[model samples]
Target: MKSRKGVRAAVTLAAAALGALAFDGTASAAPLPPGGGSWDHVWKGSSGDFTIYVKEYGDVVSICDTKADGKTPTVWVGPGNGHTTQYWFTAPGGKGACNTKSSSDGAKYRLKRGQKYTVTGCAWGCNTWDFRDRH
Candidate 1:
């Protein structure tokens, strides 16, 4: 009877240890931005494809992109650990007439007469890029 009790206590301790390990990583869960809106769009780069998701932290907009299959997207902020692509403001990059202001970089991602912003994640990489307001 004494041995049986010891075995049961050991098993319970092991189970508790495992549970603690599982919950250890939960603290880093991605912080959800206001309005529950994500600005992630699938993009197909020359090397591969990825998805860009935008969100807000405090007063800044963040952008994060992950590879569609294998390759990781090079974000201006950091690794695409599911939440490393957050941005605050956007300055005009590429050349185009923008209809909507990008919340990620605060720049207008629009279309230009002789310029083009390589937009990814649209019908296999062949779509005219334009910034559309989120509804």
Candidate 2:
């Protein structure tokens, strides 16, 4: 009986250690930006193809496409309040050139401060990230 109890405790400790390691790895995989009062940029893709870049500042987001590649860079923004409405943005310009869209250039959507939103970028494929408007 004593040996059985010892084995059980060792197994539990090992499982707990493994669980902690997994959680730590997952947390480190996607790190959030610092909250409020600053701008943050998030992007996806590589130099071999095209890159989709997003500049988020306060309630505004700007998207840029780095290559032509026949793939259009797009951004999807949705407010995190259980709302189904999502706004989108696309880079504007000719192919094989850098195209950008922001409030200063043309039509753009505005995010609400203090609201959390999911931003997804797509050029070759789609990648999603979360952003909170704290400013």
Candidate 3:
């Protein structure tokens, strides 16, 4: 029932809309990163007076002590998978402290991924301090 010009105009408009999409900046989904991104399991454990956790992301390692049930947690990180370098952080300003780490200058201790480490200096979450599992 519509005029041929109207039909032709409608078709032209649709084609133009599709053409605009073809030139859009977006393309196919991004490709995966090299090495396909490797990740190791995090380790966490708690003693009679505390709880601790250790995790590794890429080249970075994080240790946390979530003072739970009035217990201080001990966290640990081990140089595994040929990974010898990592970092550290203390939680809640200071409830659990890292007693052992890579060197004598830092809170020191050894902990493997999926394993838990005991904490000292910051125990029982008494002072609301969380120690960075330095090792």
Candidate 4:
């Protein structure tokens, strides 16, 4: 009887584990705020370096770079790990936007409505540029 109960408990635990794994496949929104995307792949431009960062405690979006150091100090413009500051907005078509409040200026990172920009080691305007997915 003791052996049977032990086996039953093990089976129950296994079933619960499988159930949890099953729910893992459910679709969910990005953990980051709107306009946030993985910046693992970066695009360099003539303007400067642009990185996608989160904004406003996951409320808004912004892009930052050393190219615009004159406008504001570049903060919250690095790779994000799903932080509230790293979340971004993905448009209906997969395009996304990001913003940050850590910068000295208030400009946010935005995806150009109809234009596409190249990512290079150099700097570019995040407000007028759309980050192309490297994935």
In angstroms, give how far residue 9 of model 1 lies from its true place: 55
Better by lDDT, candidate 2 or 1: 2
The TM-scores, one per candidate, come to 0.22, 0.51, 0.24, 0.20
Tally clashing residue pairs in candidate 1. 20
Clash number for each model? 20, 0, 22, 28
Candidate 4 per-residue lDDT over residues 1-135, each given as its tens digit: 122111101100000000010111344322232333432322222343333332222222334332223332122322222122321322121212223332233334332222222211212233222232221
**Over 4 Å off, model 2:** 1-39, 46-58, 81-85, 94-108
RMSD of each candidate relative to the true structure: 21.5, 17.0, 25.7, 22.0
Candidates by lDDT, descending order = 2, 3, 4, 1
The whole-model C-alpha lDDT of candidate 4 against the native structure comes to: 0.25
| Best-first order by TM-score | 2, 3, 1, 4
Tens-digit per-residue lDDT, 1-135, candidate 2 = 112111101100000000001112334322112222223444444332333334443244545454446666676667663244456756545233333344344334555556676655666655555556544
Over the stretch 29-89, how does candidate 1's per-residue lDDT look in tens digits?
Answer: 2222223343333222332232233321211222222223332233232112213322222
Give lDDT tens digits, candidate 3, residues 1-135.
212111101100000000001111355222111122332322233233322222232123233333334443333232332133233334332323222223323433233334322222233322111222222
